[model samples]
Target: MGKLLTLAKEIIFPSRTTCFICGREEIVGEDDLCDACRESIHLCICPPAPLPLDGVSAGLLYTKELHEPMHRFKYRDKVEYAAFFCQYMSIPQDWSIDILCPVPLYYLREMKRTYNQSELLARRISAIYQIPYCRDLLEKTRNTATQTRLNPAQRQRNVQNAFKAAPECKNLSVLLIDDVYTTGATLASCAKELKKQGASKVYALCACKTDN
Candidate 1:
């Protein structure tokens, strides 16, 4: 099914093209946090350690007040929110990221949502870094229950084999993007799949984490 859709897209548009916190309604160009919300938005940036996953960084910490905009970006389709990465990303200019990959959603779920939040984030980063953005490189093969509803162990089981890599990402170093990280189950599972497909290395980036 994913393949058929890919074929259809290839027959149609050949190329794929290219966040925000609180009180700031509109994020300025390439900025995740607006000036009015800068101080507080900085308050939401997540630290880079002990997050149950390594080599992943995020721009915000999901809080009660912070959830509104983040949730809007995710469940709704306010993708312009991804620009918030510009405010918080610290990727070295020489980091030499080979590819930009997004955490994938099960095919049916993506259709219903009309877009994958992570994919949109990746595209924005790809544009900024001038790297290759490959959406099809990781495909979600399952549509399990919401990850948020599952316990940690259950979440691990639910996402197993949920992702598979495309040939284009084989032997490439991929920086995977996601919306949030809670237990790291999803990141590990997706990275494992990319590694299985011969990815040289797999790193992760997300907008936020609950415990961060």
Candidate 2:
């Protein structure tokens, strides 16, 4: 009877779900992506080039295999993917950041999406590392155009003055979290505001970075 019940459950809920990237049902592990797709993911080997921010760390190189999963994580309602993605983020031992602050979304845009993807990643990191997560420390003062289509220079221009750091950030070291680091423009702008508000140092941690 137990075996029969288990079989019935799998039939009802479809225990074998397709991989997030390749759409293969023969997933080997509990992760959303199958074993073959997981093995194909190319992690970033070398650290990214220096940005305006003090330091930058990223997990994966933006590749064709990562595109669909990231799209589903950010735009689609695949919030559960945060755990899978967070596995790649590795915080440096020497940084000793005081707080984890996810890049904020404007109120209207956040309301439309129902949650900030970065915040989701930050919360997971906070829980894992026992660091305090401060959502209010930095905020998006204005809703700007998406950085998807912009060139590196234009990306900088688009996000200029877009973030406002709270005074409570004074003297605190911060680690900013984001879903992607395309041109480093968004992170640079955020770091600038944090520093202007008296943040001692700001570092960036991103789940993926474009390999330009």
Candidate 3:
């Protein structure tokens, strides 16, 4: 089964000879990004966490150059992009996380998308670090509006009370996974619910974050 799964990943996410971002047939690195892309995609420097979150970290600073690719990864069924994004998602050494919990989509939205992009990211990171991930630890109870066009205050209102935590989360230090962190309203809301359910700590890790 392991061999089969490996073969399937190779077949589905096939090795890229060119940069996945620019489609340049340059020397792509292990993450499948060429030198130019690797350089242009800036690393996210110590992003601050909002209330209810113990800490937050991100792989890259979300720039205009990344918008289309990130959009495709989340909405266009480019599930394989999770592998590429996971290459940069590093866990901080001091987090002391016990498990990963993905920020979920509402059931109806997930049914339409067929998968939550955050869940895909968390699963890959779990495999890489040998840490367990639990999708059932948190849930999206409301189908909220997209946070893309909203202002920070509006974003906060959009996701407020949208999440619920499971009893199993009690006392566990969790790291929340998502594709991107913008304003952090959504993550903070999720973290708040987790803590209310007795989570010892709730940190967030995203593939990227808005440079703001």
Candidate 4:
């Protein structure tokens, strides 16, 4: 993200185009790449997983393209990068929800980052679908370590008891939001919390994910 753009800036001249991902000076479209490169990126479409806990929805596979913008959107505050969320989103036909929710982050991280990346994605979805945003319906109860650094079993255990839902949300279908999905343990924990809080239904949306 920032690193990509910073490098890109160094090469700027009168008229220059570069692949958004690899920066090959042969980009074809707006912040895009040539056909072979674009197709080679493996922009896969994942069949809707059965919510794993309840109703869920997601857009793109967290392949190479999605990783950078999502990273910049959070770490660099490039809010405009959020466009990539819906720029590639494929709304699930199964999803019909009243409100959108972000998988809550621990307060310390949110304060440190000054924004919740998941909530930012949620707002984009809400705006596009004309749905309501309920950003506060979920809360993080524990600050867990990065899920990727841990194995699958450890990831599951790490996210357990990490999330909770607000008491005010009842009879509501929650649409949980996050930047990416991997093992889904984090989402499962959040779903459990939403169920415990009396949410009639829970759905989720993320910018990208791998392995469907």
Best by TM-score: 3
Cα lDDT tens digits, model 4, 172-203, are 87778877777778888887888888888777
lDDT of 2: 0.88
Q: Whole-model Cα lDDT per candidate?
A: 0.72, 0.88, 0.92, 0.72
The clash numbers for all candidates, in the given order, read 3, 0, 0, 1
Better of 2 and 3 by TM-score: 3
Tell me the lDDT of model 2 at 203.
Answer: 92
lDDT of candidate 1 over 1-212, digit per residue (tens): 69999999866865422225554345333444455555555423444533223366666666565678778888988877777644555454434568888888888888899999888888887887788888888888877788878888898899888878786778788888888878788888888877777888777777776752
Q: Pick the candidate with the highest lDDT.
A: 3
lDDT ranking, high to low: 3, 2, 4, 1
For model 2, how does the per-residue alpha-carbon lDDT over 38-63 read when each residue is reduced to its tens digit?
Answer: 88887775365355588888888888
lDDT of 3: 0.92
RMSD, each candidate, Å?
12.9, 3.6, 6.5, 6.9
What would the TM-scores of all predictions be?
0.76, 0.89, 0.90, 0.80
- Candidate 2 worst ten-residue window by lDDT: 43-52
Candidate 4 is scored at a TM of 0.80
Decoy 1 TM-score against native: 0.76
Which residue segments of model 1 deviate by more than 4 Å?
A: 1-37, 43-54, 92-95
Stretches of candidate 4 off by over 4 Å are 1-19, 23-37, 47-52
